[model samples]
Target chain A: MAEIVLNALAHTYSRKPNAPQDYAIRQMNQVWEQGGAYALLGPSGCGKSTLLNIISGLLEPSDGEILFDGVKVNSLPPEERNIAQVFQFPVIYDTMTVFDNLAFPLRNMKTPAHLIQSKVHEIADILELSPLLHKKAKNLTADEKQKVSMGRGLVRDNVSAILFDEPLTVIDPQLKWKLRRKLKQIHDQFNITMIYVTHDQLEAATFADKIAVMYEGQIVQFGSPHELFENPKHTFVGYFIGSPGMNFMNVQLEEQHFVFEDMKLKVPEKILDKIQHLPYESIKLGIRPEFVHVWDKKNDEAYEVDVIDSEDLGTYHIMTFKLRNQLLKARLHEDQRIPKHKAWISFPDQWLKVYVNEYLVEADDE
Target chain B: MNKIENNKAWFLVLPVFVLVAFSAIIPLMTVVNYSVQDVFDTNTRYFVGTEWFKAILNDAALQSALMKQFMFSFTTLSIEIPLGIGIALLMPKRGMAASLCLVLIALPLLIPLNVVGTIWQIFTRSDIGLMGWSLREMGVAYNISRNPVDAWATIILMDVWHWTPLIALLCYSGLRSIPEAYYQAARIDRASRWAIFRYIQLPKLTNVLIIGILLRFMDSFMIYAEPFVLTGGGPGSSTTFLSQALTTMAIGQFDVGPAAAFSIIYFLIILAVSWVFYTTIMNMQKEK
Candidate 1:
């Protein structure tokens, strides 16, 4: 395990980094601590994989330095980085037997033959791949081939980190869960620094100790899965992390009152004073589907809604409604029923989030 | 699943099958008919039951030509496959450069085969040709038309120049088909460049290499036009490969029956050799 420090690291594919948009990855300042299970999560083409590649030393950054355990490694190649990586698809040597595929890196490093055998057997056992060890790798099932890919990476004990790049995308859903669990177990047992890159929220939430949410080549937020869910730092995060993500309604803020369309809702005295000094004309209110409560019209704080659609998802229902021309989704308990024509919804004060120009506006100090 | 209801799809392939059968089957029937007969003139002919086959088998010249053909094919394949793969590795993976390399490499293949032979014949001449002049200026006695060593060298070099690009192009396509993710996986494994090439790139190229080898072997074994035009199978028959020998027997000596029998033997040898190469590669792939 090693502490990885990215010091103003940036990359540009072009010769001249003349424009801001020309950079594939902007200056990134981060410190991923030793033994931490980190995830770089984002949509496609967001520089997540690029960042992973830079760290792995497959690509050189245009500027700045990367330090692993306080030693500068920006000039090091991948072989010198001492990291293991599992790719999106299995990259096993199809001509080699499963045992040989797993044992290749060890053999390349000139590890003793007996030790290679024992270590391969150990990883095969952990991955439940011992029975198929004698078989050629090409004949294995997709899931089994993926296990061989994983085993190849895992067999090396001296690797400073293990990187997984959407490794489960090709795997069947059933096998993905088992592999995720197995990866988690390996991480726990070995305590190596692991960085997993994926676009899937569930996989990110399940495997990562800290999730670094990336959008448009920048890390928007880096925190635990719960922090991302409860307090998204950017609007992209709010819309990206949850199943039915947080809904945003544009509001006009004046002096001490917030107006949503024609309805002026009194703001909490503290939040009102903080935004008064900012020069933003509009404030957006964000609330998760689980936080929006649908209630009777007689409820004092409830705002009126026109139900758009309702999808029954076995355990719960996702009820989509419109409030002042903005679409909003609400999650209701299995037994809860609401009229399709009109409904009243209310946001709990604690769960209400405010954003100014796509950036999260922190709550005011009391 | 029920049988696919797309009957119209068969129309897309009908023209191809029809063209292939017309070109392939008719010529094959002609060859088969010629193989079993002796033609004395336009009208006089006799059915020779395996007499020509026995004569061809016993012919010392035919046996030597077969040996020379195998050696030429083997040498050409040995030189071209690795050279092609090396050039392919040096090629850029993307952008205009990759396209440029592809176009340049494909130029030779696009040229008519006889034209390639004619061009090389002039290019390797001792007096006026640039290659010959340069070699002479560099203090080497090089005359392809009269010297067996020079003739052999010129032919091998020409074969390499003409066909190495094909292997390289096939290898390039195979290399390009590999996803970037595989390289990422290699990097994470901390694999050396050689290890990655051996384990990942080489195995990935095996299928294409098999095809490349078979095509190159068939072409080189049957090579007649280029060497015939350049050296005229002279320099003392050193470059007289099987196809040249067959041409000499049929056209030069006009022994139609023996030549017909020789061609059948030649075709069978190619078929048997190609089958061996294909089966060996497929079996190796299966074992993996």
Candidate 2:
């Protein structure tokens, strides 16, 4: 397996992409270490598939170079690039038996007859498709068909990476969990670089070792799931990851206090110093809904807000409140007292994030 | 629950009854009546008791003509199916060029049957037509009337030119319905071009090809107007087909009794052949 590197890669569907809007994938760079489980996570139509296609060599990038193990692979076809891709929908040869479907890649490579047979059996056993090997692929259920498709890729040993593009969209919710666990097992067993692309944050977080948060055709932040939740580098990530997501309020810096619409809050010296180095234009303050501490009584550092709406979501409650006319969300535990119409909230220093131009500013050295 | 036997539902089916009667049963009954009768006039007809049917079945010329018709249909099918698939495979998948090509290929299919006959009739003229004149200039001796081989070749070529596009268009739509992901997966699997076609394209195209084959077979089997216009049972009745023979007996010579029997036999042949083809293809699908 090779370490995949996308060096300043960009792509566009137009013949001449003169404007930035014309590009489907804007110029960016990313690297996936060998055997790393990475998820390229984004909303629908955010170029997650485009990036995956490029990495799989199905679609060549308009600009920049793709290196595998530090060697350029721009001129290589997908077959020569040694990459396998599983698509959003299961793709299998309908006329063939499940055994033949799994054996396809090895047969294509002209592996010896006995090796092909043994490899097919191995992959079929791993996918739990040994019993259905004699059955036609067309007759299988959606998840079984998906496993067969994935098994086609796994049958070959020469592949450098396996790219999955929303492979669970067609599967029912009940089966998705089992299939995902199977994928995790496969990853652990084979130690090959796997890049999973999806719009569901839960799928990304649960399956990937490192989740790359993509926004507007760019990878905004790449880190572990815990890191992405603890610190979303971009405002989009903050708004995307959690249940109600992180609440963001546009603020202006004035006299060491962050001022918003009809509201003001003092900042610590270290955070203020970091904010000073960043441009004062387009400043925003962000905090996760889980971290916004709601209080029944007014504290010294608390800002009182009207509790506009609160949803009882079984275990916890998501309370939407207005802070100085700006709406915000906070997650409260089940045992916490429910505020009627008014609640005092405090943005704790540790949870508060100062954003300059929609990008998070480090309040302290890591 | 009480079971009520109501006779009123039959009235609700009157439209279908009248439709089936007018469209099928009436005409078929008339043919059967003619097949079994010796009718000098509508008022003076006698029950002949299968005499005409026996006579028609025993006709040697008509038997040869049926054989000739089968040959024509078989040849045209064998040529058109593979050629159509090849053309579909080679066709551009999208954009302005694809649109232009589709329209051009469909042009001949829209032409009236007689018009197609007239076009090919003139187009293959040895003296003036583009192709015929070119062949004559190239020192090739080609005359559709005097030579049986030339006549057969011309009719087959004309039929291929007129009908290959229908199959091609069906196959093109079928090929387009296949997801792009299949091809991408094949590429990643390192499949050869032939392997992709064999396992992917051909399997996906099975239903469309079945429909195309049955359609072409039935249409070619019943073909009349084009060949009739071009040849008119020419030279020595060498190109006479089942429909042409029936038309000559019923309309040309007013041999209604034998011609009615002939038409019924022709209809049965088409039905039986199409059913056989459909069932065979379906069984193949099931076995796979």
Candidate 3:
């Protein structure tokens, strides 16, 4: 296994692309540490697959050198790179038995027959496909075929990494957890650098120790799920990384206080100090719904707004309330009283975030 | 839930049955009628009862022609199927080049059979034809007449040139339907080019190849025009296929009874062989 690095990597489907919008992957540099589980998370059409293909050497980057273990491998094909990829859909040899499907990579390496047999058996056992070893891969279910596809990746001995391109998309929801757990177990066992690309935040968060949140062909933030939820590096990250996402609204500085359409939010001096020089129209205030506290109405520091709606979700409720002319969300615990017409909510200074020009302005005592 | 039974649905299908009766059933019945009767005229006829069938089956000339027919069909299939697949694999997947390739491959298939026969006849003639002239210049005695082996070779070559495109087109469509993920996975697996073809491409091609094999087999088995135009069963009747023999008997000699029996046997052979082959290949797929 080796650390993967993308050096000034960029890609454009057009031969003479001149505009940034023409790029499928914009110029950027990143490193994936050896033996680390990482997720490249993004929405559909945000170049997640394009980036994954570049990593696996399926698509050559229009600009950049991809280094494996500090060796420039920009021209090497996937076969020479020793990278294995499991695609979005199951891609196993249909005419082969599950055993042969799993054994394919090993056989390709000209590995001994006995070793291939044991390796395939080990992988099949891990994938819960031992019973189907003799059955044709085409005869198996979609999920089973996907497992066989993954099993092939696991069968090889010298693979530098395994890339998964939304490998769980076609799986039944119940089996998703099982397969993810199996992937975790394999990561622990093999210590291969696994880069899983997906659009689902839950899938990414659970699978990777760190996730690179992509927006418009660039990775806007790369951090742990907790860091992403608490301190999003970009407005898009705040808008993408959590359930119901973070609450954000444009803010204007009026002498000392941050104001938005007569509604005011108390901004920390440190946050204000960093964003003071930025353009006024570019300023934005953000806070996660979980951090928006619903307090007692008798408290004067809290803003009491009329409740627009509250969606009951078993263990918690998402309370939407109107403050002056702006609506905001606050996640409330199941044990908390469900406010009917009005709710008093307060934004904590520590949880509040400042943004200038769509990127987070860090004001923490770092 | 109680199912709603509607007999009126079959009324919607009555047209198809009527069409089949007029197109296939009545014509086949007439052939059967002629096969079992000795008829000088419509009014003067006698029940022959297997007499024509026995004569057709036992005739040494017809038996040799049947053997030649099998050889021709088998040769053409063996050459065309692999060649078509090869051409398809070499073809580009998409773009202007791919579209151009598709149009050119489809050109041969769009030609009428009669025109194709005429084209090949003149094209392979010993004197005036390009192929014939080129071969003569190269010191190879290439004549579709006067030499049995040369006639057989020319006819087989012409059949391949005319018909291989159908197989290629079918294979190209089949290859296109396979997702790009397969090739990606194959590459990631470090599969050799041969391995990719053997395990991935070939397996995916089985369905289309079955169609290719069946269509080519039937057409080549019943081949008449091209060879009839090129050689006319010449060179001591060495290349006289079953259809030519049947044509001589039915039209030239006016032996309608024997020709009818021969036609029935020919139809049965094609049907039985195609069914057996299709089932065998399908079962092989299932086992895999």
Question: Highest TM-score: which candidate?
Answer: 2
Query: Number of the top candidate by DockQ?
Result: 2
Provide a comma-separated list of chain B TM-scores, one per candidate.
0.88, 0.97, 0.93
lDDT of 3 by residue, B1-288 (tens): 999999899899899999999999999999999999988986988899999999999999999999999999999899999999999999999899999999998898888877887888888776898888888999988776777888888888888988888888999999998898999999898888999999889989998999889999999999988778778888878989989999999999988899999999999999999999999997887654
Q: Who is ahead in TM-score, 1 or 3?
A: 3
Q: What iRMS does model 3 reach?
A: 1.4
The weakest ten consecutive residues by lDDT in model 2 chain A span A272-281
If ranked by TM-score, best first, what sequence of candidates would result?
2, 3, 1
In TM-score terms, candidate 2 sits at 0.98
Ranking by DockQ: 2, 3, 1
Instruction: For residues A1-366, write the lDDT of model 3, one tens digit per residue.
Output: 999999999999998998999999999899999999999999999999999999888999999889999999888999889888999999989888888888888887899999988888888888899999999888898889888998898888868899999999999999999989999999998999999999999999999999999988999999999999998989999999877888987888876788888787666788778777777557888999999989856487887789999999989999998888778888999999888897888888778888888898887685
lDDT of 1 by residue, A1-366 (tens): 678899999998999779878888998899988889989999999999999889988899999899999999999987788877777878888778999999988987889999999999999999999999999998998889988998887888767888888989999899899989999998898898999999999999999999999988789999999999999989899999998999998888865778887888778776776777888855888999999988956477888789999999999999999998888999998988755779999999888888888888876562
Pairing residues by index, what is the TM-score of model 3? 0.95
Candidate 1 CAPRI category: medium
Give the top-scoring candidate (lDDT). Answer: 2
Could you tell me the TM-score of chain B in model 1? 0.88
lDDT of 3: 0.89
TM-score of 1: 0.92
In model 2, which runs have C-alpha deviations exceeding 4 angstroms? Answer: B2-5
Number of residue pairs clashing in candidate 2, backbone atoms closer than 3 angstroms, sequence gap of 3 or more or interchain: 0
